[model samples]
Target: MDSKRYIQLLKKFDGLDADTEGENTRSSVSYAILSNSETNQLQKCLGARLFEQGFQPKLIKTEFNNFATDSLDTEGELFQSDLDFVFFVLSPMGLKETIPSELNERSQFASSFLSELEMFVKNFSNKGVKVFLANIPETSERVFGNMSRIYPASFLYQIQAINAGINNLVAKSQGLYLVDLASKANYYGLSEWHDNGLWLQGKYPCHPRFFPTICDEVSAIFSSLVGKIQKCLVLDLDNTLWGGVAGDDGIDGVKIGDGIVGEAHVQFQKYVLDLKNRGVVLTIASKNYEDVAIDIIENHPRMILRKNDFAVIKANWEDKASNIQEIAAELNIGLDSLVFLDDNPFERGIVRDHLPQVCVPELPEDPTEFVDFLTQLNLFETTQFSDEDLSRSEFYYSESERKSLQKNAVDLKNYLSMLNMEACVKPIDEKSLPRSVQLSQRSNQFNLRTQRIDEMTCEKYIKEPDKFCFTVDLTDKYGALGIISCVFMSLKKDHLYIDEFIMSCRVLKRTVESLIFNEILNIAKENKAKFVVGEYIRTKKNKLVENLYQDYGFENTERSDEGSLWRIEVSGFSDLDTSIKVKRS
Candidate 1:
């Protein structure tokens, strides 16, 4: 969508009535914009972009200089609003007003400024709200000119110090993110990003023409926070990965790895290899003979990604959409996680029309620009990375091997026993907290009552007396699957309520569910509870686990349009016999 159309839609939404606005909002996300300058134009641009990305954005803009105190209501009590994200949009001039211009007095002012910012971030993060701190941009007007470069306490030096300090804080903090506004301004050129005439009259830091670029960055950050990050990249074989069709032109005739045109595809493949190394799954969904494609992939010396690199290869004469669905099912991920890349415009259009969830970027007319175009899209922006992420492709390969073993076993019990599985259940601590939060954010298919949370909330559950939060790490004879399941339960006087239950889809049929259910019963029994309650919250991707409570002997208590409530008496709980070993810590 164009910038003018986006502005028009924002005006239409701004004029909507309360009831009509509430009715149109889907997948509701509450956010706040705290800025010292006029932010109505930026907020409108952000809302339009977020809405285009399928989020129903509900935003509140605080008055200038009210960042700390605006969270409270008019009665001087804490407000009941549940905010998902908060953006602190700070301009260098706004912060300069509070700090002294004298070189000798600047150190004390910097200390106090950082302290106040840290306190504000901590206050909101304790409530599970993600905070985005925009780095202060440099002043367009150089007051000291060349002297500012040498002086330690100059305005430019102070701003750079603050940005460095913010980066350090974000590195240590769990839920705080840094927006590099200075680098973005430098890229777009200061002359185009800032207008001195408009800034002097209206106090607008950024020019109106660059609102679209600013909002695109904001939209990318918002998408990453809400688990909209893409996981897999599905590629086509002929003309997409090489210079020509392999089947028609023959393997030796296909241009690759020598000339300028072939070097473009080579560079593209090298870029894709980098993505795979960072943990994005590489896949192939081509419409060629399976054996013919595999033979070329195995023998081609210039190929950056070989046969072993792909998690799933659907190289048959099938429709592209169906091939993508098969890949999703095989990988046990949502369709939204896949990004389809094809050189043919017709193929791209077919996938876009049939499966709207998949992200399909428009390839430029020149193949030489493909790498630059994909890099600019930033479709796989992630805030956190772990050791498990680096080894994710290996984990999927292990899962495929496990499935083959399951098919050959005599029965369910024999299959599980032969695998030799061991589960370690432990309370959430410093070492296990990162993976636990990741599982909460990523798991979808086997999740019952999906409750997304941040690291602070997971830590709170671990420290609270009446709450029980634990993670399960499983290892078999094949390999170690790190932190596959998580459970959060709240203990009441008469009953234990299960707040969240989620497990990785790779370990679904190995009786891990039964083991976790038994552990929950044990906790309830130890607390002398009368009943244990569970819920099945329906979602677009969680239908696989809708009947989970029923399968676990939890009697249905009430049914609603939203979800079903279930309860099982402690006395009625019985243990199931399993061959896997369990250790509690």
Candidate 2:
């Protein structure tokens, strides 16, 4: 969107503030900004952006030019309130007062600056809050003309060192995230991003006009928390993957690799291929005969994406809306997880009207601009990524095969035994922490408490004698489902409490839950606990597990508006039935 229209939309959205307007339609998130510059405008932009994206975000205000003091003050809003995310927005302009003029002194200054910031980051992370610290904007002050690139003490070189230090800090620290302001500034162009006049007048961090870009970046990080992350990218065939319709142009006539238009299509396909490589499930929804499109994708020499790359292919004359719905059902994913890209406006409109939850980007008329458009949209944002992401498409494809087997199986136990399932249970450590925390963020329907445990807290649990954080990795005849379940527990005086239990939806009906629950009982027994307590906090998406504790022979001891609480005697509890064998690591 253009800046003018964008500003108007934000104003309208900001006016719809649920905090004051009492409109409770969207999910609400609490966030605060700690910046060394004026951040009222940044808060406004972020709040509006969240509201636009189906969230009613509450802005926690902070003192002006007091980021350092606020970071140290435990009584400040940064520490006092519960927040989904806390952003430490930074700007080079705000650091002008403290920066050293002498080239020799910059190294010392950068080290001191990072040391202080890292200490504060640790403090906040200890509070169990997710921290987002923005890397300072990259700048070329032209201190030594063309030689600035080589000079060790030049401003450009020093900024690079500082950003690198920030990168290293966030990399090692659990629950801390870098906002990548340098990359955003470079993308928007340094000159166009900052407003000198506004900075001088009110200490604005960059231009208020581009604040939405930063807000969007922040929203992407929290998207997984609310289960808003997109996992699939669905593509159209004619004019999208190639220059002409595959049905009418035939395999040889379709322009794919030899001309200007064909090269543009190839570049777009390359981008889509990159998404697939990063674990975005690719699917085809083309309004054409199956053989014609399949022939072009398989036989055409210039086709970058082969038939195997797509998890699902619906090449028929059916309306794209129906095709996309079938694709989601076949993959066992929500419609909101799908992103549709088609060159034809009519198809885009049809999908939007019928499947409003699916994200349909307006593909640019020119094929060359396709990549840039999607890049700016930031459709796929994730909090954590693991090697398991690379196999996501294959994982879903295997589900279809499993369904075929399920149709012919005699019973549940027989089906599970036929698949020959095995599970490996292990404690959360440095190696398993990434996927452990990721499952906490990603699993919604199967999450009992919906508790998102950050890495730092998980590490603390590993060290604490009374706390236990462990995960389960499942494998069957189909393939390995890496780290499909996780359980967080703490030993009380007389009982073991299950803090969080999350599992992948793909493994729901496969007796994996029974295996994990059995593990929980074993842990309680090992700890010599008298009782095992399980709690289920109600959520809109977690109705699948509303009766989780009840189903597992946990007697309900307490019930309230929030959820139900159950406990069972560890010694009296019998093992839940499961076909899978266990392996401990």
Candidate 3:
């Protein structure tokens, strides 16, 4: 968001004085901030952000300047409460120290700083809490001036050493992420970010003036961890993607290249294409004739994206708000998962009115400002990314092909047989850890129990010999959908328990579920187990799978306000028949 909007929102947050009663009691998520500095305003701003996202913000904080005692003591209130995540804010000002004498002394300082960080993070992570940390911001003392690059006793050089070690430590530690506060400080300029007078007087994390920006940054990281990130980009034509109207100026007359004004649009196109490369599905929802807009996409020399690059295209004279709805439905994604970019104020305002869940950034009139404005929102942040993410756009193309074939087929069974599907099931090894954890966070609609596991807990499952953690990748005549489903199970005596089972919505009616169910029965029978158990945890979006166990002939043994439980004897179980071929790894 822009600076002006940040101030406006903070003002709105300041007016919530009467609604501040359950600030300490745990809600949906209990978040604790253990900072070495004063965190009164930081807690307020982060709570405001979470409240805006439809989540109950249970803010937990430590006493001022006593973060160490709260973090290190396991029996303290910080750990005693049901805390889900934590942020460890550190700064050099909090830890008083003397400057090193020479360049060789920098390594010693870095080692000590990293050791302290490791201790704090490991303390929380050992108890199954996710940790978010920030490196100390860099500031120059001006002792060596520009010669700090080679100077023997430069604070900047020492800061660089400490930051380097922070990266290595976070990488080695599972469920730990290093959020760079220095980068944000550099963006807003050091003068606005650092206030020496306020630091000495009240011990604020940064200048109180810049609290809005930093708190927004930290809250966005938590948002992505809960699988609330946008997945698609919906674009508009005319002044939004080019300099002039396509109908009024014609394709040859439209200014997209060979001119000074056209270069700005070209730069914006490159930024959008880069988002596509990183697995953001690109789609167009413009108010134009289909043939004319596609001609430009097909023949324009400066266009960075082509017609095939998009997963769906809705170019017609219909209202942009309805077009956005159609795009979401066609892709089988949530309306909140789309980021719509339109240059016209009228179109943006209309969509915002109709779909409050959709993210509509206020694009400046100047095309040059488009990239920077969108980059600052951080709309597509993610907790985990994998090689499957890089090729996810192809899955949409495969979906399109399947839709066309289904339209011509005689019936659902014929469509399934025509595709000739195949499913490859494998145990979750170290190589599949990243994608498996990502699916755990992303899938909801088809999840059996919707258990979100982190990499560290999953690694423990891999090493425990008795637990079964596996993944399934599907392919057909059309194309491949990599790692689309997963099953995590364990055994207790004679019964095998299915803790979590999740599948992508794209494979909803493809009989992939039947193949997986057959595989689970096989695993239980091979282990000489007497019964197979399954669970159904009720959530807002998981109603699709509430009757899944019943359809498979598992008897419902238990039901409650929480969820339902089912069990089937192995002697009575029969293999579920499916058209898809199966292979094991």
- Least lDDT summed over 10 consecutive residues: which range in candidate 3? 18-27
Please write out the lDDT profile of model 3 over residues 1-585, one tens digit for every residue. 245645655665576554554543323667888877887777767667776665676778666777777878889888888788887776556643444656577546666767876897899988888898887787746577898755535667667777888888888888787788888888887766777787789987777666667766777777777667788999998988888988888788777866766888888888888888899988899988899999998998878778888888889999999999988877777788899999999999999999988999989999878888888888888867788888877778567767878899979988999998888899899888888888888876888887787788788778876688889988888777888898888988998899899888888888888888888888899888899999999876788899999988999999986789999999887888788899998
Which parts of model 2 are misplaced by more than 4 Å? 18-27, 410-412
What CA root-mean-square deviation does each model show from the true structure? 3.1, 2.4, 2.7
By TM-score, rank the candidates, best first: 3, 2, 1
- If scored against the real structure, what TM-score would every candidate get? 0.90, 0.93, 0.94
All candidates in order of lDDT, best leading = 2, 3, 1
Compose the digit string of candidate 1's lDDT tens values, residues 1-585: 235754665675575334243344358767777776767777776776776677777776556557667543333222345777877777666677777867798756656777778887777766677888888777766677887755667777777777888989898998888777887788777777666677677767677666666667777877766667788899998988888888897778776799987899999999988888888988999989988888778888887778878888889888999999988888888899899999999999999999988999998867799898897678787767876777777777677777778779979998899989999998888888877777888777778887876787888898998999888899998888888999999998899999999899888778888889889999999989899999888877788988889987899998886789999999987986666699998
Cα lDDT of all candidates, in order? Answer: 0.80, 0.84, 0.81
Query: In candidate 2, what are the lDDT values of residues 115-197, reduced to their tens digit?
Result: 98888777787777778889988665777899876677676766777789999998887778888888889988888887788
lDDT of 3 at 439: 86
Q: Which ten residues in a row have the lowest lDDT in candidate 1?
A: 71-80
Cand. 1 TM to true fold: 0.90
Over the full model, what C-alpha lDDT does candidate 2 score relative to the true structure? Answer: 0.84
Over 4 Å off, model 1? 1-25, 64-81, 96-99, 107-109, 139-150, 407-410
